[model samples]
Target: MISVLNLNVQHRGAMSGVLTLGSLDPAFEGAPAVDGPVQLDLRAVDFVEPAGLCGLAALLELLTQRTEHVSLALSGRNVAAYLERMDFFRLFGGRVEVHPDVSSLEERERHNPGTLQELINFHTEEEIPRIINRISEILKGKEYLLRERVAICSTLSEICANAAEHGTSSFGAFAAVQAYNHIVSGSRRAGEEVIISIADGGPGIRETLARNPQYKDHTETDNEAIRHALEMGVSSTGELGRGGGLTLVAQISARSGGSLSIRSGAGRVTVYRDRKNSRNVPPFPGTFVRVSLPRHAAEDRP
Candidate 1:
């Protein structure tokens, strides 16, 4: 029998959720590699951001490859409904089994085409704008300022482009966006916040960076690698006029009072409100990036 893996709900809302998912790698690694089913318990999970779902999908993808079967036990009615609305079952389909077996995957897919579009995998460069345009529409619906939308889209475009060019994954890269109502702490006003997550199962940042002769001497730990990658003008390709994607994302996060978190290999970095923190955590197989952008008025643009 496989031990049940419990996911934390408090961390299931944004960048924190991606880290929470990364922390599970060790547990899964320690679990016995039996042919029987492994259970993922999501009973305590109350909130799940798009980043969380993408992380979960990546974890499930890894688990499905290693184990013979995998099952999910959802906590409550609300969580079940949330999963249904997100079309989680349809995405995984036969790869993951839901306990108590609610709706057929085919039925869910047929009814929830719109939600499925929010979580997508892209392989070509042309598909990047389609994802960006969809996210722009969602942000526009929330009344975010045009400048803010442009900044967010620019950051997203860079990150997605990086994934396509460097991720080197046969399965391609995954991008997901989730918008939800959140309270702005000091203002005490409810506003819409959107989280954008892009992940790929490929050689992580450290391995990629080591390819450059200049960076070869850096002796980067995973955290250090992520930090270096975010530095302006740093590129694994050793090319000039190229390599500011992550730096732009960081600037957007700092200026807008948002947050950016990236996990590659065993290192994790979070930048929020102009402060940056880095640490070594459980190793994630590939690269996972989540950017949280809160609603900002037109005048708030920097």
Candidate 2:
């Protein structure tokens, strides 16, 4: 039996929300049939509740391994208006549609070259969605397909996110996007050639590994450090599932015919879309990677 679960909950600081999950049969009615394959509707909601979001995430988790469509539609005045709204999506990695009555924002974004909104000087955990949305707008200006937008956004996100996670991000890392925008907009003053550059004054990757016998044999050179980090099985971070983060970026660049350039330990390596030149040159102490996608190619079917 197909059913709908409607919930209303009040949070401590945020507004109350009306949340709904469809095909949530009390009997687990469809049992294994409730994958994201299930349809969800929140278009009728006024505001969202975190518990409700949790309930939805729980449902998605159960349906994760199943091959089905658990689709949901949400219409809200603000995409992230509800507290814990982002937490829900992060839980299941499930894609939820946040539709506002955007018959016009879509149209403007479709034709307008782009819009840059300067967020906080330093970003906080609370600021990620805004950045993502900004990049989404830029990609839209570039007229990219959905997958391409996702890829480019993810690449940009990884850089920003890693900076926050490992660097000086009490509120969140700030310099990178600031720098990127300054470069992209040609607004930088004199001799400041950069889109964004995030620097972490922490111990370098080489220094970190020197303390560990496992990777003690590894050299601290920029190319070697990056190559090692991007190859899987090695990470300056002791955290599990991390040795491959940079590797994923490399794969994305290779697959999409984009470019991946990184400046770390002592230099930089730029992997061009043409797969022609991947240079390794000595530079500074911080790690920075930049990727540029052609305007027309931002939407090349994945």
Best by lDDT: 1
For candidate 2, the per-residue lDDT at 2 reads 27
TM-score of each: 0.84, 0.46
Per-residue lDDT over 1-302 for candidate 2, one digit per residue giving the tens place of the 0 to 100 score? 42333333333322334442212223123434343344545555564322233334444434443534454455654543332223333333334333343333332222222432232223344555676677677556545568867865665565566655554422233332211211211112222111222333234455555556677656556566555555665665566765554556566655544455565555456665444333443333335555434322222233
Tens-place lDDT digits, model 1, residues 76-177: 566566666766766776678887666743354435333224568777788899998888887787777799789778877878887887657665688887
The regions of model 1 sitting more than 4 angstroms off are 10-36, 104-117, 184-189, 296-302
Clashes of each: 1, 13
Model 1 poorest ten-residue lDDT run = 108-117
TM-score, prediction 1: 0.84
Count steric clashes of candidate 1: 1
For each candidate in turn, give its C-alpha RMSD to the true structure in angstroms: 3.8, 18.1
Error of 2 at 197 (Å): 6.0
